[model samples]
Target: MTDGEIPVICSGKGCRAPARWRLVWNNPRIHTPDREKVWTACDEHREPLAHHLAVRSFLRRVEALD
Candidate 1:
């Protein structure tokens, strides 16, 4: 293990790549307006993952990690 090594990986299905972004969202049907759900994504999976949530109107923000 290293100092900057995060244990979490991308949320993309079957993808084991390290996460480089944080997808923040809320499913209004199941959660309160302020309740947030997060999904991690690597560079490659970021767009598709975000798009999937956004089309459903669930994506709130995409935060790039250092």
Candidate 2:
């Protein structure tokens, strides 16, 4: 880790593992139809996290971390 280098963290509850993926989402009821929200996930939590959002129709897509 270095100054100004923020670590990627998993979005899963209570998890601190490094993130390897990005979950793109938006709460249509709360945000504009084109607005996007982002959540980071680790390899272990990616599926569960993505599913959680997907079930709510909040997930748009998942992509590898930049």
Candidate 3:
């Protein structure tokens, strides 16, 4: 929302809110154990997005954005 600041946009569809949390995930069927994928999320979308990944057993961790 300002100059020199890279936007950490939420991964939720159509949402433009800045990210406050990081969702770490990976599909074991297609990715190696060491491979980790990430999805950025705002406070509002964090639960929903995390749920989506968690249901598939792909969610590894949820961490607050630094």
Candidate 4:
């Protein structure tokens, strides 16, 4: 978020938009209960990306990109 710093980008395939949200998740089958992973999303890809994770029950929380 500073000058010369690279912006975070959405995780959506082939989409190169800057991220505005954070998707927190983990695969229970391969991770400990307290473990967490993250995916970033632009406003446009947020919903679809969240939906993909929700369907698999991998999504933990969504937060604004800091």
Top candidate by TM-score: 4
Q: Which stretches of candidate 3 lie over 4 Å from their true place?
A: 1-3
Each candidate structure's TM-score, on Cα atoms with residue i matched to residue i, is 0.88, 0.90, 0.93, 0.95
Model 3: weakest 10-residue lDDT segment is 1-10
Report model 1's TM-score to 2 decimal places. Answer: 0.88
lDDT, candidate 3, 1-66, per-residue tens: 579998899999999999999999999999999999999999999999999999999999999998
- The ten-residue window of minimal lDDT in model 1 covers 1-10
Q: Summarize candidate 4's per-residue lDDT along 1-66 as a digit string, tens digits.
A: 899999998999998999999999999999999999999999999999999999999999999987
- For candidate 3, the clash count comes to 0
Error of 2 at 42 (Å): 0.2
TM-score of 3: 0.93
Q: CA lDDT of 39 in candidate 1?
A: 98
**Candidates sorted on TM-score, descending:** 4, 3, 2, 1
TM-score-superior candidate, 1 or 2: 2
Q: How many residue pairs collide in each prediction? A: 0, 0, 0, 0
Clashes of 4: 0
Worst 10 residues of 4 by lDDT: 1-10
Candidate 3 has an lDDT of 0.96
